[model samples]
Target: MRTYSLDDVYATCKRRDSWWTVYFVDPVACRAALLVGNRTNITPNAITVFSLVLGMASAGCLAAGQLAAGAVLFYLSFMVDCVDGKIARLKGTGTPFGLWLDFMGDRIRELCCATGLAYGQYAATGNVDFIVLGVAVVVLDLFRYVNAPQMKRVRDAIREANAARTPPPPGPHEPLPHQSFSHSPVPHQLGALTVRSHPVAAQPSRPPRSRKSRRRLLRRFNKALARRRVRTHLISGIEFHAAVFVIAPLLGQAALIPVTSVISVLFVANEIFLIYRMWLFTRSYSAVPKPEKSREHAPIGGSPNV
Candidate 1:
């Protein structure tokens, strides 16, 4: 067990639970979700399904030319999105599939919203405004999807680096028994096992050579790598939502067009920043040598990689 081993920062993130736990006002929500999740076997994926239904319904409202209603539904959709993850964490039902679903849901929501809005407005009047803005919508999506992978790579790199920077707790495993004890009065060929990690001191600690240290370090490394991935995916997906959310409505919210337009511009800036963040992760990830030998891969923003 080596002293340089890194801790699982992402695990801490997961343990923290509640989607908005870091942002406060979520402790109460987290407790409630945990209570419900504990009572029922509802996994994170189940909540995702609920979110999807609400989102689709909102999209339906938007397509039916109910802008205000659509807006409210959209808000609920976002809230559901937040609640499900928190519940998953509270229930300890966060699985890889659930994570993937959550990620995909966000992109789906963005795509549906902008595309549906375009569809709705066009069906109503076949206006040039919707037609013109459609180009922007497609362009934004293309960039969003295409850049996601690169961004993810960068995030992975960052987590790995961070984990290395912050070491993990030592393992408690005992060492293997010794082959034999040759120091007897009658030198016997028979050997005995060495007591292991339970009482670590008597356990002849192995340093990088130490089993406990190595295991702990390895775990941290993997978590860091995972964190990089989750963070990158989340940021890019969020950017997509931010774009569609602000710009698509700008088409009909003529009074707030200027404000919305500014937001859209900020989305572009966000894209650039995200790309930069990805580059950081990539550099950090590659800095660690071979993939198999490297530490646990953590997700970005303290989440573990799914």
Candidate 2:
């Protein structure tokens, strides 16, 4: 069997990925894991289980107020988390159980990390506020995790209903004489098509306009900013854990705890808003009357044959 390259593994296993995963973490860690995995009989589920163990160890370290050690273990667990999906894709060994285990592991890790970090902070600072914040973090995170799937199902249902209600495009048998065939080859009556070659035109170049160029740059920047905001709000599991455990601990900044807590609150609010919108959309969709099946099959009232 041929070994999968880092690029191949990444291409096959990448999810709705975050910038940290794409640009920083997975590039190095996942590559190394894939390289090791190719030489070993390690399965993706095995990796996922190992990651969960590591995450638990990380939480233990955090609870013991071993910040640096906890940070290192947390990152190590995340790296393993990245590798499991890649290994699954590479070996074609992904199962529903594996996926469920993976998701469960992520949620457990988040909860453990949140609780551990809060306890560690309280132990270090002797502040009850840390404990409260920690509990809030876990609750918000859990709500986001649990509600997200339900919201997705609602949105999907709405999308499916809308798609069903909309009429499909006319088939070849239907009249569509006005439709353009400029790009496609002309079809023959004998079920074949032939391309008619046309001469290409060279267009004249225009000088760049400073105002228009500035406007274009502004638009691009705004679009990129908007995308970044969305990705930040839709924070991935590893990203959130890494920020609180790894980055904050390394920086010796306990301020990140409150900051991340605030972010979690905002994220919860965003989820609530999304759920409301989805509910509204579903209600509106449900109120619309569907066409009767018999009427669909009936002839037009003004047909000459009728």
Best by lDDT: 2
lDDT of 2 by residue, 227-284 (tens): 5432433455445656677877776646656667655655556666777777787777
User: Cα deviation in Å at residue 58, candidate 2?
Assistant: 0.5
Tens digit of per-residue lDDT, candidate 1, span 251-304: 455522343455457767878886676666466544554334323576455645
lDDT score for candidate 1 against the true structure: 0.58
TM-score of every candidate: 0.52, 0.69
Best by TM-score: 2
Segments of candidate 1 deviating more than 4 angstroms:
1-35, 38-41, 154-252, 255-260, 276-306
What is candidate 2's TM-score against the reference? 0.69
Task: Evaluate model 2: give its lDDT.
Answer: 0.74
Per-candidate Cα RMSD to the true structure, in Å, reads: 16.4, 10.5
Q: How much is 64 displaced in model 2, in angstroms?
A: 0.4
